[model samples]
Target: MEQWKKNLVVLWFGQFLVMAGMTMIIPFLSLYLQFDLGLTDQHEIGIWAGIIFAGNFVTSFIFQPIWGRLADRYGRKMMLLRSGFGMAVVMALMGFATTPWHLLLLRMLNGTISGFNPASIALISSTTPKNRMGFAMGTIQSGGIAGTILGPFIGGLLADTIGFRPIFYLTGAFLFAASLLALFIVKEPFDRAKAAAREQVSVLQGFRQLSGIRELTALFAVTFLIQFAMMSPMTLIPLYVQELHGTTENLAFFAGFVGSVTGLSNLVASPLLGRLSDRIGAERVLGCALLGAALAFIPQALAGTVWQLLAARFLLGVFLGGLIPAVNALIRKYTPDGMESRAYSFNTSTLSLGNMIGPITGGALSGWIGIQGLFILSGVLLLANAAWVWQSLLRKRPVRSKA
Candidate 1:
């Protein structure tokens, strides 16, 4: 009934569509390069695929803060619409690309304009009641996770049925539709005059001001580490699954299951843990969840069977669910007024940086240390991150005396 609630509901769907559209290309990206683009060499196809896939994140990492600053000055809803519509056009053009270079450039362009998720988050964070912030962040996060879990599967199916190009058109159509939904339904109570009256700052100045705060700096690191740890083992999961299963038959199915199971559990746990964080404290939820996530990775490193690894990943998801929402809640609590969008944008930039670096580092390390050892290394990094959270956030809280 409330305007903020309406915005949250609309933006949840917006997040879902944005993530789903972005990920839909994953299923057939290499296939598109090899078949449609006429790349005959397998190695060339692989290289092109990697480049095109990372291009979006590469540009996204650089541009998120710029967009965030604009959102703070103009309006978050406008930024959201700009991204949604801009990405819609770029995604549709990918369906028409005649070369790998064309696709790569389009992907980069899409990433350059991509700010729908962060803008939605900033808008919701600004409008939602402080007490309900955890729940709102968690609920919105579940939307993206849900989209991530389903996008590839749906893309694969649609690619087979309607063919690859049609899937791109379909994704673009869905994204456009989502944008229209927000345009009509989502109401942002942005005080443009008030925002205009505030002292204007460059994006670099904004970044420096936010990063100067110790708590925000620590929170930013936590964001990066969480993404890095999760994404590092991602590209190597299939090899580990193969080792555990000891067979090639059904390998794709098993690997897909392992890849998606974490998101499935994460989707279920985010809202629940978010509510718990609201009742107790986001700091407590974050600390305990980090420790739980760190411990969960140990079993993955030790598992001798694919089933064991699956169970471990599912457990890890339960804890992973708490990290982002709690972090977002804390960011809102600590950020100075009128700069919330910039703060969230900076955090998103760190998130994109982690996403870009994680797979590369994971792929590199897995060869030297092996996948199992890589798992152990990831766990150790998370444990160290947990310690950082304690020192920087949890331990510094002023104790309240009981009446």
Candidate 2:
């Protein structure tokens, strides 16, 4: 097998492990706060849960570009290992937290060190053949989505069986194992001496240089909007499910299905769309996906039954699956050589920013507008974003794939 193929395979699993470990705590995060940390009030648990959940993304948004710069200067594999191992230790410490503050701080620290996913993207992007970039990005994305879909399920089960604290230790152990896998198996052909020879650019300078490109800047905004639109309705999905079902009976099961069904369909669509992007061009796929995603949201907003909402969300996933891989492929195509990591990092920063702000905004707005209204608003936002994508990307002839 080719070196790039080898790296892609290893990094795919590595991305899976990283995402799974990170999300494993999600199923019982509030439970941990209330029971283990002794937060008695439901209101207090809700507040603390919100803070703790957002904490990682808050610090991750600030630090991703810094690490991206370093990855460009040094190597992406090193950055990947650093994040994997660092997060391993921090996640383990969460198992030992004695207070809500301790858990919150640890979560923030985890965010501060989180770069494995972006680094993995940068690594695979740099190494993979340009013609296969779409497929590579899509395949790697599916791995993370697979992890995200499975993590909470496994976490929920383990929380009930082995208890919460040990799940942390188990997550940490899995992360450590993933890091070691990368250390031994993944090979990055980063030219450090050549990278060193290039004039060093500060993070701000790099950001400016990348943002100066109109398309790259537009791509960044697209990434932000994608996350923002998708994440905005995530926390409220259960309530919406309850509303649609008209009862709390089997609410957890129904909610879990609705929440994960999008990802399940997304998992199936990503690689298929990715190959299509490789043939037809990522820009076209991106624009069409955006439009399709926007249209899909309308049904979710209008659905009066749980089954209807589930079907709508699943359809939405098919388009949502195409967005990120196309964005990553386009980023690589447009980025100047030797700055790919930095470009990906900046995109990751925007992604984290959206993750951090989306839920808060969703929760805040849902009270005023209601869940159905939030869905309408999200669809409208995505329609506007689709227009932006059309103007910024599809208006230009897409770069042809190399023969």
Candidates' lDDT values, in order? Answer: 0.90, 0.89
The TM-score values for the models, in the order shown, are 0.97, 0.97
Q: Provide the lowest-lDDT 10-residue window in model 2.
A: 394-403
> lDDT of candidate 2?
0.89
Per-residue lDDT tens digits for candidate 2, residues 4-29, read 88888888887887778778888899
| lDDT tens readout by residue for model 1, 241-313 | 9999999999999999999999999999999999999999999999999999989989999998999999999
* Worst lDDT 10-window in candidate 1: 394-403
Number of the top-ranking candidate, with lDDT as the measure = 1
Model 2 TM-score relative to the real fold: 0.97
Regions more than 4 Å wrong, model 1: 398-403
Kindly provide the TM-score of model 1 when superposed on the true structure, using C-alpha atoms: 0.97
> Highest TM-score: which candidate?
1
Clashing pairs in 2: none
> How far in Å is the alpha carbon of 371 misplaced in model 1?
1.2
